[model samples]
Target: MKQPNAAKQHKPLWTKAFLLTSLSNLLLFFSFQMLIPTIPTHISQLGGDDAQVGLVIGLFTISSLLTRPFAGKALDSLGRKHVLLVGLSICALTIAGYSYMAAITLILAARFVHGIGWGMSTTSLGTVIADIIPAERRGEGMGYYGLSNTFALALAPLTGLWLMNAYGFLRVLQLSTCLALLSLLSSLFITYPKPPMPFEKPAQRPTLADRLFERSALLPSILLLCTAVCYGGIVTFITLFGREAGISNVGWFFLCNASMVLIVRPITGLLFDRKGPEWVLLPGAFFTIAGLLLLSYAHSEANLAAAALCYGVGFGSLQPALQAWTIARAAPNRRGAASGTFFSANDLGIGLGAMALGALATYCGSYAVMYRYSVLLMVVFLLIYGWCLWQAKRVVRLFGRTSN
Candidate 1:
């Protein structure tokens, strides 16, 4: 009896399904992250300006925003494997198309379609992970899973840039397409868990609101959105900003960021599991704020690496913790919707940040100033999160009084 109880207590988190899923996610992110910094550079090489670059990122995110809600519903209703396959196919095809197109308009069109694939694939993968991971060890499992993204971040940008510099943008695009194909292939082998409540029939079909979003997941989504705005700014413009600051190799920043994230993720995950999000989020936010502030002034590679380290810890810690929070707050049956809501919010934030901050950079004529301005969003995040905590405490106290 004691052995059985201990075995149940230690239910495996790293099952074959989880490993395959993580591998799929890693490869997908490698494809995605490899393109992120290089795309803006590609546009520049094609005689496109900064605004065009912004439009490219914005359009991709907007299309993703449009697709994620529907994808979430499909994950719940249609099942995970089919939705994942469809999404991966779309991603693979669209990514391959980039190498053939020279016109900005064609690339933009492709980007819109690519966003749909990204929305579906990411939402399905996240939902599947939530389904498979044990409830008790969700934070830890998510942390480990997110290491894929961290590793991708560590290697993808540098690899992409190197390929682009050595051979050409065509080579970079070719490699990215290959990576996407590999990710798609890897996903085909995963054994997905059945959706919760498969046998239960509802009295009424779900409304659009019910299909699109989960109310329970909103707080964490909102919190995630704030940080994502800042993230969007970084992802879209950091390479150009590196040039503006006269740094020869901006790739090192990603390397440093990923390195720090690799170190911080496990520790933060353990802390989140043992203590709570508050223990991680508050300090994480501070670190992010400091990192951004430091980045605003970074002129040397060392300074850039320092900024990345701080930002990495903050961003890395906050993301998984928020994801875990979203999953924990949601009903098992609604996990798909919750994942969609969370990712949709993330896309929206990134879109907004890319568009708005890109314009701001244009207006100010300085990337450094733009980064400094982006720090305000993080400040807003901290304020809103703190207010939520205070409100929660007040509600608890009121409940105590009512009980008396």
Candidate 2:
């Protein structure tokens, strides 16, 4: 009887709800990824200058940042279904709207709205996954869930580009809109958990800070931000860097990177659950640093592939580990806020890293040199993590002394 009870306690991670949510997440990301590489080209074709092309991304980022906190608040207070449905509706409509926009300004406006929906939908999806997955298997569950994104990233851009070449831009938008609608449809079937009611008395209303962010999640989120910064530099400039190095086929780098990530993520996730973050993080950072340094000097496809594989291992290990850590630290009621905080930090880091590293590349007169400097960001990540550990130990020691 006791053995049966113990077996029952180990709830399955791959439930129907989890699968539906993951499917929805996969479709959502696939639709969004297909648009990312094509949108700038669309703006350029519509008589927009380079500055306006940049605004297409910039305005979207700003709107997403503005919407995330409120989305988080709504998810925790109003429940997941409402926020998820509203966000998916906005995404589907905005994607369809993109097909009809004639002017650059209209496209930019639509992109901004799309970002708001992106932020809300992503946050809600993350919270829903957290609610459904078994606590003990969270790292493993998140690893599997994130594969949807990895597969989308690897396939969507290529597919989008192919569609654009064959049928033109309008077809791309129509297909992306259809994908968003399918994502929305899949989401409707998910049985969401009830919203976690506040434990505080009615008179004790939540504060502004309470509604905006999860305090317990900040530490791991900071570490995640540092990694995102390095990632931003890579994704933004790697193609240019390859050209600067006299390499023609830079696409191979992403293919190798994605392959390596697919291999390492599940293993790293299991290690994080059983061994601890230190087992994954230190080696992950080392691999990332090695990858960046190699990439700075890579002049051949083989070298580029090697660098990509190394970076893939590092980033693939770090991202899900930090996210699982963030979710683990937060109360059940605050998981939505925690996910929002995690994503917000990631967005802030990427935006800042791109802008700052672009300036560095300009100043140094070489994208290769810019990558060399980007390694410093990862170094900072390791240092900050070490300091956090020391602080934790010191507080523990002081408490022990006081008790004595």
Candidate 3:
């Protein structure tokens, strides 16, 4: 790894840059999230079936996934502030465009554009936080930075649903655009870290390898894909899933879910920094497995909320823990690449999961049955995670014995 930037200095956690950037993250996420539930409903309103709904939802993720590799390179080469503002501008325009789109094809097209904005903005935000935070405190800092989104999560679902109910899809799209604009305005105030000077003379042209992906972060990114697959199922269908059980509002579940995430996010980050991934992830794996199992059987508000609490705690802790691991292992100069790689894997899994789960729901004739498959995926993830850990230990022991 390159030597840590000599300029990195100890600063208080809540600097103006961090605060403003966090606010920007919060607002951007709110705008993006407000459409999550509403969009599927809107697709249905436009005469799209569940399969078509999945296609529209999944396309956004596919678009973002395709762009993340390029966005990562841009974060490193272009100024963070510039990339950020451009992303916000795109988000503002694309969100407003949704209001004008009546056909399913048009909505899908708009979602694709919107995903590009989402991919760039989120990648930059994570990289910006990494640039500013102290290395020793990165786990904690990432967890705290994530709080902006998690806190926003607490409100976005209910508010989005409420807007849809009160003002309809068109107005929801309009209000979502306003939120994106606010995110852009807040980003304008964020202090961009001084751009790092490249250690070597610039190449005339970069190769495909450098532009494509970050190698050091691949392990964590792949692992995250496993978890994100299950998360996608929840994000894409939980509203309709709840309605399947006679509950019209999914706010309570998200409320409980976000609350648990809010509570554990910082603590798990601290634990990851202090005690390492083994301790933090073991419990997380258990929580995730149990949560999915519970969710598959949810039939009442109480049961649904209980499932949310479990999933939230698991997901909340694991995401930052894994992200810290990704960035921690990466060379400082390539953190933007790491962030991009991580989020790309994240979006890929979500997109595929939504599509696959939706198809399964269609074949099986209900979302509840599809969730049973999500539970199985979670279990498989834990098994894979455990096997990888065991293999790592075996490799370490053999290397030690050889050196001896």
Candidate 4:
């Protein structure tokens, strides 16, 4: 009799909290994605040089990176619901301000504010969802939760590009503001338990050392950084690479990539739960390596699409696998810090990769050459992932002998 009620106490993966947070995440990502490609064009329009474009795009991520540790502290101290709503509202304000800006300095300024909001919102949302999900089912739930961003990743850029051509930058940003507002409203509907305190009450105020990052999450976060740098190459230069390779239309590449991601995400998460991270991450690395190599020499639309498929499958699977593992291994009360650590790694990887690979592309004489070089990072990821697996096996063997 108690068993059934015990089950009832555990929320379904698709609880109101999950749905609202996911929808809010979708809206937030949609608004961000809608502006991503257009921002560079806008920078160019403002008479900024290429280096300035890099600064404009890169600074947003820098701000996000800088804010994540503080956001994590806030999420742990404040309620998840409180942090989430405030973050969304901040994002909404920053986006609205973008609609009224034209100068490069103002645009860069808005991006900085938007990054703070973005960092806070994403960190809180990940922590909140980690709260709702049962430990056993975290991988599955996070996989589904990531779909909202996947949908946005698939659709937003096309819409943004279309809108820019048809309605102009101001109009597109106005629409972006509307989407962010919708995110805030959705966040308002979420009801979640306050995040529990991480440890016994301290005798004094927590120090700066105590305020940032979760040590338990650091391993997977570091591993993710390697793969994420590889991803930066694709996100930053895939379109230009396609053009360089004589493929005029690259929209289908993302559509196809999103399709594979949708198909494999749930499956990979299920695999992670049953078999552990090694099985999922190792093969995923190989897929990524193969994809990058193929992308280097792609000529036909078909080869390009194949690269998208392989890379998408690899990234889609490994990303949530890392996220679930990061939070799952964290102390129960420290999910917020775990999430912050995870995303900070993401921001760090993407920002560094974008700049490093951008320079690498210039030195190598083409984006194609740069992607081929990016494979070397994925190779390092494989080595690190292998070490993680070895460590996992050693622990399992140690436990087995102890039990015996």
Candidate 5:
């Protein structure tokens, strides 16, 4: 029950390492986002249809999901730095490979390879941070880390689109490859902390409760899954949807959305550190739900902009809170597994949601239908979470009474 002492805890070496790692992730994500706005269009240019585009995008996620458990276990055994370097190097190479391929199949292969690298890098970096950051400040640290990616998400797509318009897709691809290489190089400067070994003895097996509940840890994980599902719908289909709705300059909508996230994330982090996640969750959820609704009804550029602001605020606030909570409740030895689990759920929600939404859009003849469906899903998640919170409080009260 004793909380880590804030005054006594020194600035951890892993914190600096995590900052570098986060920067690498930022660049990597930036490069990917740069490609995102153009990828479907490129696939179309290459004579692929919507189904093929969906397949290509889905391949990346499928590869990532399949590799995560292995990546997590490897990070636990092989150490973080080794896995980090391997992942980043592979990522850099894959980005370069994109330039050499015009075939849809080859592009899908490259994305799959990129997904493997993403799985390794993300799992290792998260595990390494878990080893370094203090529980009390974990929320704050994770928030800052999340901000790095959000910053990239904000700038990368617009910049990439502009460059693509100016110089061409080939030149944009070259820029992305260079950024990925920079990310790979950045890993060399990161000094990863030594992670604890896995428990070996039969008696050292974690309890059923530890495996199932993770108690407070489940809070963030569930919230993350919900948020990811919502985000997946927007990120994957919004631009295409906008184009369908006869909106011009769909890229600007993404730019505004990312900008709002970048602006709001740090403030949310500060709030999480001082006020706890409970206070932040409801408002964030509201914004997201509202954003999705507005997006569904968006008939003008102004409506799209308003939706972006709402969506950004919602997403920016909740993501870090969930990450911090997941790490905070995990035992140090199992933190890698815990982070993997968290990310697995996140990946599953996002990947599945996108795929399903794509299918729905195909049949429904409107992206708005998908948005409405997601709003329903969000409502379900909120109900489940609310019930869980109530149950948790009841258990705590009962335990306190029995103890007394």
Candidate 6:
């Protein structure tokens, strides 16, 4: 028999879509991170306490989690570009609303609305990428895509703080709003490949398993969720915790963390592409566990720097690995659903962790207590990650046996 022609293999339209979508995500996340370091301070300015700040941030995750399934369905039925435009428009409007809202409740409501838009947009983008990139290259592609957001993380917060100090909060808000609008403009340039048509009969919808999982999906999704809980706690409260510990310029911590992620993410992505997730994930988890533990006892600026380096390396490496793994396991037609499932798990973990950490902080009367608690949570996550690694090895062995 003639060998199949490898020359006929061509880069698909989906790859182009992923590139544009990644750019859009980068701009959108840049706008978001610009606001991250300032949100708590804004809440306080509007007469909200730490508990209220927690609610405001936690509610955004809740809104996103609640709408993710619907967004997935919409991606299947409505097409990616249509869903994306609607989401970006709404996100821009809600963010503008946030700029003007003075009441904590109104601000929370605006954030919740923004979260809905975020859920829809990001879900559609991931699905669009899945439709474009090849399965074997998914990990590498996803890692490249993730770097866009990582770039935003590295720069946005520090810029925001500088603007806040140099000018005023209103000026910072204006800059943020401009970035959101820029994302909207960039998104208009993104084109999606033809989406799978909607099911003719709503009742004939595929089961969740048929939509989200086929082979290695479950393990990666679970791992991402666990990591998200760790992420949520740190991003939401790290500044406050640092301030409480007498660390001035807490924005520097975010700066350092994001910078490290931007630097390390590409190298890790290459590693994932070559050696596979098993090699990257175990060490990633250990780094994260160490970071959280160090953060628990951190007081001096030097300790904070150490913790940021550890977190940047660990969580930064793991996120792209998990995302790529989840997409790699799903059928081509079901990539949107798989993305939805992954993001939903992520949203839930972050939401729950923020709420719990907030409550703990309220009772304990110190942010250090929250960090200590997070260390304990990381321990649990480490144990679970170990079990997942064992299971993944067994699955590989079984597959090898069957192939023989």
lDDT of 2 by residue, 216-335 (tens): 889888888888888888888888887799999999888998898888888988888777777888899899999899889899999999999998999888888888888888888888
Off by over 4 Å in 4: 1-11, 199-207, 399-404
Candidate 5 yields a Cα-based lDDT of 0.77
lDDT of each model, Cα atoms only? 0.89, 0.88, 0.83, 0.85, 0.77, 0.75
Tens digits of per-residue lDDT for model 6, 31-119: 88888778777888888987898777678778888777778766766677888788888888887777778788888888889889989
Query: Model 4, 1-404: lDDT tens per residue?
Result: 89976785464677888888899899999999999888888889879998888887778898999999888878887768787888888888988887678778998888888889999999998998888877777888888888888999999988998999898988788989999999999888888876776577668986775668888888889988988887887888888888899987777678888999999889988788777777788888888888889889888889889988988888888899899999878877778888999999998998778889989999989999999989989888888777766776787798853110
Runs off by more than 4 Å, candidate 5: 1-15, 198-219, 243-246, 362-364, 401-404
- The number of the candidate with the highest TM-score is 2
Clashing pairs in 1: none
**TM-scores of the models, in the given order?**
0.90, 0.95, 0.87, 0.93, 0.87, 0.84
In the predicted model 4, the residue pairs found to clash are none
Q: Once superposed on the true structure, which residue ranges of model 6 sit more than 4 Å away at CA?
A: 1-16, 46-52, 99-105, 196-218, 243-246, 360-373, 376-379, 392-404
For residues 1-404, what per-residue lDDT tens digits would candidate 5 score against the true structure? Answer: 23445454445534567777788878888888888777777888899988888776788888887777677766766777888789888888888888889888899888899999888777777777667666666766777788778777778877888998898888888999898898888878987767875456547676744443334455567777877887787878877888887887666667778788777877886677677766667677888889889889887898889888888888877787777767766666667667777787788889877877879888898898889878876686678667766776787898853210
Q: What clash pairs does model 5 have?
A: none
Candidates ranked, most accurate by lDDT first: 1, 2, 4, 3, 5, 6
- Root-mean-square deviation of candidate 3: 4.2
Where does candidate 2 stray beyond 4 Å?
1-9, 201-206, 395-404
Q: Write the per-residue lDDT of candidate 1 for residues 42-124, one digit (tens) a residue.
A: 98889898789877787888889999989988988889999999999999999899988999989989999999999999999
